[model samples]
Target: MIEFLNPAELPRARAAGALVAGILRTLRGRCAVGTNLRDVDRWAQAMITEAGAQSCYVDYEPSFGRGPFGHYICTSVNDAVLHGRPYDYTLADGDLLTLDLAVAKGGVVADSAVSFIVGGSNPPESVAMISATERALSAGIAAAGPGARIGDISHAIGSVLRDAGYPINTEFGGHGVGSTMHQDPHVPNTGRPGRGYTLRPGLLLALEPWVMADTATLVTDADGWTLRSATGCRTAHSEHTIAITDGGAEILTLPPA
Candidate 1:
């Protein structure tokens, strides 16, 4: 279902967004070549508890997934992209890592994701892929505003990724989010503008633009959660939750300094 935030709940939404952002920033900083993905999940659990917040993932059980996602954060590495369930794996140098997080505070929820390289040995291809997702995310955000159509935002995002010569995967993209991590008004990576749901003020959207380095096809891992590129190529994802306002969209998730 598509859920919009009330004026009274805006502040709480902002707070939840901030917490999600801060957690992502902290996890990114602490992630290293030798860091274990499971340990990172543990750290996220501790931080969420300390902040008096709730994890949107840990007990989440959806038909798309094999079972409940028993983790606090999604730790996707290299070819993995969406729903990357954390496991016992150590990061390696030059590994493209993606961290997706969502949390609720004061009954409001915010979701966001980021992709980065492990260690200092950043491969040129990996760097370019990460940059493309970021650019697409920015383009999608720029296209969002009151009265705008959801297709407009999707078109903006797809234009960037496709123009970059990367295949677009529409299986998973952005979505409406407010009190829950995932909501209605599904936003695909590519689409025609002037179509889909009409944007309205007070609507909160998580605009994520993600892509695989080569093929658009995806293969599920043995864990039945992590989505890896079909060709085993690298992947990257970028996301943010924004609230529609009077003039334009306001980004809710900004990491604290």
Candidate 2:
């Protein structure tokens, strides 16, 4: 379902967005070498509960995933990319970790993701992958505005990834988000401009640009939720929830100081 927030509802949406961003930043700061994946999940759950917010992922049972995800946050390391279920793995230096989070507060939902290296390890390839996704995400946000077509955003995102020598995957991409976590208007990472759904004020979209280093194919882990690169190549993902407004697109999810 596609949802457009009324002016009054936009404030609630922004609040939800801020909560999600702050939680992500806090969790990211706590992550380091030897930190257990379950620890991250625990931190997220506690923070959500303290904020009186609801997790959009925990107990989530989408058709494509195993029932009841049972995790507060997605902790994807190295080869893992999307829908990564927290496990017993301890982070190591130079591990590329992606944290994707969504939460509901005040009847509104916001979703966002960030990719970064753990333990101060600065692998060149990992940095490149993360930077590429960030660049693509920025491009997509820049292309979004009232009256702009979804294809324009997708095209802008795809151009960055393609120019960086990464393959594109369309099976999973960004989408409309509001009171519900995932909604209509699937925004592919790559597409032709001037096509697809037209943007309008009050529309909220989660624009994510993700890529695997070598291939566009994906493989599901034994856990039935974690999506990894088919070639075991390192991957990165960047996302932000944006609202179309009278002036332009307003990014709702940004890490707080």
Candidate 3:
């Protein structure tokens, strides 16, 4: 289902976005070598409760997943990319970590993700992969606005990842997000411009651009939730929830300035 927030409801969307962003920022600061993935999930739960926000993932039971996601946050490390279920693993130096979070506050929801290196060890390949996703995200956001086609955003994102020498995967990509965590108007990472749904004011979209180091293929972990690169190569993902507006799109998931 495609959902749109009226002007009066935009503030609530902003609130949800801010809460998600703040939680991610806090988690990123606390993450380091030897930190357990379960600990990350616990931290997210506490912060969400303290902020009076509901986790959009805790009860998420989409068909693609094994069952209800019983975690507060997605902790993807190194090869793991999307739907990374928190498990018993301690982070290591130079491990690329991706935190994807979504929460609801005041009846509105926002989703966002960020990938970064865990500790003092910053591998060049991992750093470059993360940078590519971030740049692709920015390009996708820049292409979104009133009158813009969803394909425009996809094309903009795909161009960057392709130029970075990374293969694009359309199996899972960005999507409409509003009252719920996921919605209609599926936004692929790559597509032709001037196609797909036309942008309109009040529409909320979660634009994410993710890529594996070598392959576009993904393999599901034994846990049935974590998605990893088929080649075991490192991966990176970046995302933001933006609200389409009269002149342009407003990014609601940016951290506090």
Candidate 4:
């Protein structure tokens, strides 16, 4: 279902976005070499509860994932990309980690994700991959605004990833996010410009650009939640929740500095 947030509801959306962004920033700061994945999840849960917000992930029973994800945040490590459930694993040096989070406040939802290197031994390849996704996400945000087509955002994001020499996966990408975590108007990473749904004011979207280092194929982990690279190549993901307004797109999930 595609949802359009009225002007009054936009404020609530911004609050939800801010809460999730703050939660993600705290989790990112705590993630270091030897940090347990479960610890990150616990931190997220505590923060969400403290903020009086509802987790969009825990108890989320999606068709593609195992019922009731039962986690407050997604802890994707190294090759893992999406739906990465927290487990008993310590982050190692040079390990690339991705954290995707969504939360609802005042009945409005916002979603975002970030990727970073775990320790000082940052692998050049991993850093490069992370940079590519961040660049692509920026481009996608730049192209999103009222009267723009969804394909324009997709093309902007895809161009950066393709030029950076990473394969694009269309199976899972950005989508409409408001009042719920995932919604209609599936936004792929690559598409023809001037195609797809026209953007309108009061619409909320979560634009995410993610890519694998080597291949486009993905393999699900035994837990039936984490999606890893088919060849175990490192991956990175970047995202932001934005609201379409009269002037342009306003990013709602940037963390407090």
Predicted structure 2, TM vs. truth: 0.99
Stretches > 4 Å off in candidate 3: none
- Candidate 2 C-alpha lDDT tens digits along 1-257: 89998888899988999999999999999999999999999999999999999999988999999778999999999999999999999999999999999999999899999999998769998899999999999999999999999999999999999999999999999999988999999999999999999999999999999999999999999999999999999999999999999899999998875
For every candidate in turn, the CA RMSD to the true structure comes to 0.8, 0.6, 0.6, 0.8
| Candidate 4 segments whose C-alpha is farther than 4 A from its true place | none
lDDT of 4 by residue, 90-154 (tens): 99988889999999999989999999988898688988989999999999999999999999999
What lDDT is reached at residue 206 by model 4? 93
> Each prediction's Cα lDDT score?
0.93, 0.95, 0.95, 0.92
lDDT of 1: 0.93
What candidate 2 gets wrong by more than 4 Å, as runs, is: none
Per-model TM-score, in order, reads 0.98, 0.99, 0.99, 0.98
Q: Which of the two candidates, 1 or 3, achieves a greater lDDT against the reference? A: 3
Question: What TM value does model 4 have?
Answer: 0.98
Model 3 error, position 170 (Å): 0.2
Model 1 pairs in collision: none
